[model samples]
Target: MTGKSEHDDSEREFDYRWARDAPHKEPSARARMLAARWKENPPEPVPFRGEPEASGPRRSSWISTALVLGCVAAIILLLGYTRFQAPY
Candidate 1:
């Protein structure tokens, strides 16, 4: 095999001459008509409807929060007590 590695060979060059030399195409008749119509009469902006405000003051129920915390504490205490009494 040749002592030179694959990377040693020159990289292939890309031909961008076609893009630089290509002619620009004109817009179609239908496309032109639509563009003219859009320019003459544009659509109206939709009305923004904000969310309705709550009837009463938004406050968390203290009773519900306290109950949830109590349940979590009781679960932790029960688990700890069971682990302490577990057989060695």
Candidate 2:
């Protein structure tokens, strides 16, 4: 009888499950995480520059050489000089 009465104490506590039914107002996981990050720090807006920031000079010096060489070849071909090998 003593053992059975001792175990009944666990179940005798008042439950407030009905109190939680008022609104169940709680932030969602995302909202909670966002709030925690906001509290820890502050919100920062993303930069929206009109033109995308260039990483660096994308064109290499060799590309300029190739372009100049192509123009020279065009001028040479237009001058009616026949080459041993076809331009193609």
Which candidate leads the pack in lDDT? Answer: 2
TM-score of 2: 0.27
Q: List the residue pairs that clash in candidate 1.
A: none
- Per-residue error (Å), model 2, residue 13: 99
Q: Per-residue alpha-carbon lDDT of model 2 for 1-88, expressed as tens digits?
A: 9988877986786557855775767778999999899998988776676667789868889999999999999998877655535485
Weakest lDDT window of 10 consecutive positions for candidate 2: 79-88
Q: Report every candidate's CA lDDT.
A: 0.79, 0.81
- How do the predictions measure up, each by TM-score? 0.33, 0.27
Show where candidate 1 strays beyond 4 Å: 1-60
> How many residue pairs clash in each candidate at the backbone level?
0, 0
| Worst 10 contiguous positions by lDDT, candidate 1 | 6-15
What is the C-alpha lDDT profile of model 1 across 1-88, one tens digit per residue? 3545544553334447754676985788998998899899976675698667789975579978998999999999999999999998
RMSD (Cα, Å) for all candidates, in order, is 10.0, 14.5
